[model samples]
Target: MSRRLRRLPAIVLPLLLATTLVACGDDDGSDSGSGSTDALHGITITGDVGKEPEVEWDGELKVDKTATEVVTEGDGEKVAEGDQVSAHIWIGNGTTQEKAYSTYDQKQPESVQASNDLSPVFKDAIIDRTIGSRIAVTATAADAFGEAGNAQMGIGNKDTVLLIVDLMDKQVVLDGPEGKEQPAPSWAPGLITEGDKVTGLDFSKAPEPDRKLQSATLIQGEGDVVKKGQTITVNYLGQVYGGKKPFDESYSSAPASFAIGVGQVVSGWDKTLVGAKVGSRMIIALPPAWGYGKDGNPDAGIKGTDTLYFVVDILAAS
Candidate 1:
């Protein structure tokens, strides 16, 4: 199992939104409506869409197999194969009728590659559904976690799982030609690049920390400007001001993908990278107020008063 599958609690096992690819098995030929007779029969979900839903089950609820039902129809674009989907999910343990996980608590919905490694029940319920649709579905242990049930969530091999999903948005991932590189701004951190690879950074003339966010485009791109709420792929290098070496960079590994403007990352990244065009490289400077606040990220060796610097290459956005 991938780290995404292994680390997440079983309730939100399907909520792994990381960019890494995982191999999935073919469907076992179970009908989407196999358990429709009992679907949504004893269950009730009430609340505004896109927010935490109130779930209640009248009595003992059980499903012998997999099933799906639409709780509310949507009027947006219908989902299709290969679309990167974003959704708010709520899961409950059918046997115990206890709430398991809700993305609403995180304040940000998750985005995943539709039809990729997802349970057949989830794919069937979500595919062809329009954005804004609210759906309820049931999955038998075999349909969900299989023989190795999750012991942490008290789900046994025979336990059934219930899910409520709100289709928030979807986008078709598109590939575009790289944009032409432009000259770096005079005030930006000095950078040495060799055909899109940053080889060296110079901060000798960098400004002193002032607890404010600052940004300068080193290489302007011609592609569409990235917008808030869109998922983007980027390669970046980061370091604390006055550090001997960069703290992190995506060049040595896979490019990072995350939804912008949703606080998925630090506020500095959301503010500086949202409007940058694909193929562009920008340098961002973040003060304590926007970098990590008073409690800096200890694991990264960032301190409460440390200023952070980043040079980011915007690769793709959707």
Candidate 2:
């Protein structure tokens, strides 16, 4: 699943850097409810609601305890505690003035739940926030990850960590495409049987490849037409033209969600899926020029002259 077709630049950093923990005894130094705005004193953030941001601070910033601040007030729906918050996140080592993690690099947001199991620093940052809100959380390395700190991320035990979160909309993911069924073209790829809806594609009867981009809708949805710059959720399967084996598919796993028509995906997907309505099911073909170009995604076992064929089910968009 970790392939170039899903993400050209593969950088998926977790909200918290993971490390094994060994409990020696009961510790009373928990960061929950130990929130304050003292850490935001000299920190400055600049960016729009749905874009990556810039964080700057004077001197060496330090956080003895976890702190939280609302940089921008959003007028969207309130997210109840324990509910999932789908957000684009960025984290930097304030002590080192170095960037550590960001979802913005992949143009994708991940759904994070703010429960007691989550780090107390993160719970304070995400709980009870409204969609479209911009928030900042600062903490000592111990409160953020653990006392050991994340050595791989260049964070030390005494370093301060700054995290910025843009609360994106509640992600809408579907098992499969659901909409009005329509007749498919004769030359289009056929579906493989399962219990009901499926993403397994069959290209046995498909014709030879061509030098053009083409698409055909198999199901017409009643939802809003997808627009450029919208982050879309979809279950898709892709194959090299005339090949029986698929290069990629999301049939049994979680749906992929990313910004569309903004170069987050290949040109073929941006062009064909932007104008499509949510819940629509379509099959598309992308010649090398519209697909991987001359490189042809060598990592995906595709050649320089191959065309990529895909069957996509548009689940939702925001």
Candidate 3:
């Protein structure tokens, strides 16, 4: 049975850029020409880890079932369940031997959790693998997308899919604060205690919106200062001015990771969080102009006129 795709919480992080699967013919299970003993013999890939691979295959490349080969074994930490893994993947069509999607084109690794939501073959091949590993896997239609296949990707019930993945980094999910505790700023609008399980926000008296962004450090960190354009992982809580409760919080969910100053998040976060040291706690108040302007996120119970308030904990940055 095909498993349901679990949607992750809203964050600025980029997961998979493209997942296109298409239907193709079956292979005879015979060697085409290459001397390799693997089921996929005609195909040959040449490239270093972290770079776009050059694929050479002529005739129809097909696999009757799922198979995986470790191109390069890494020396880094082994990946486990619930760990956030960053990888660059190149997917090719088995029928035409043409490239479908590649993260190399974007010049950034897409991060994903090692969960069942991913293809069974893919999750099985990468989990427990060490970082910096290069993996090549072939999956049948049922093992890849599903028996029904995806119409959007032109995938059919019997087609096979090929994937070449470069495992870049892996991070275990953090359960709580990892930095030294500091007192919340007296002038800050919200209060966050180090020992408190839940940090409450008092929006009854809203701070007046200002032309410039207001930011204060609540905890001091010993890590390196964050640089622009680098991806960072964080835990956060957000609320609108004059609201009784927080509209969103990563404290209750997994920490989010995203590149900074890239317009993926609100302008206020892009401006205030950059240059801050990793492991630091910060409070940033965003005016409507910096936040979701005029048409605020109604799903979050934020109005167009509401000012956004945030208490963020910087965890790690790469």
After superposition on all CA atoms, what RMSD does each candidate show versus the true structure? 6.2, 5.5, 6.3
Give each model's clash number: 0, 0, 0
lDDT of 2 by residue, 52-71 (tens): 99887766777676667788
Lowest summed lDDT across 10 adjacent residues in model 2 is found at 18-27
Distance from true position, residue 313, model 2, in Å?
1.2
Q: Candidate 3 on 1-318: residue-level lDDT in tens?
A: 000011232221253332322223233332221123484545777788889888887567677776677777788989887777888878776766767667676566666667544554566556787898887777665556556653444456666667788899875434444566666554457564456334667744544655356887777776778887767778788877666787787676567676677666777888899999887778888777787778776677777787777888887777
lDDT, residue 238, candidate 3:
81
**Model 3 global lDDT (CA atoms, 0 to 1):** 0.66
Q: Order the candidates by TM-score, highest first.
A: 3, 2, 1
- Candidate 1: count of backbone clashes, pairs at least 3 residues apart or interchain: 0
| CA lDDT of every candidate | 0.68, 0.72, 0.66
The most accurate candidate by TM-score is 3
Tens digit of lDDT per residue, candidate 1, span 1-318? 112101123233332323112323345644553345467757887876677888888765676666787777888998886677778878677888887667777665666556645666677767788899888887765566555555555666677777788988885443322555567655456775666666556778865656668887766777789999776767778878777777777666545566677766778888898888887778888887877778776767878888888888887676
TM-score of structure candidate 3: 0.75
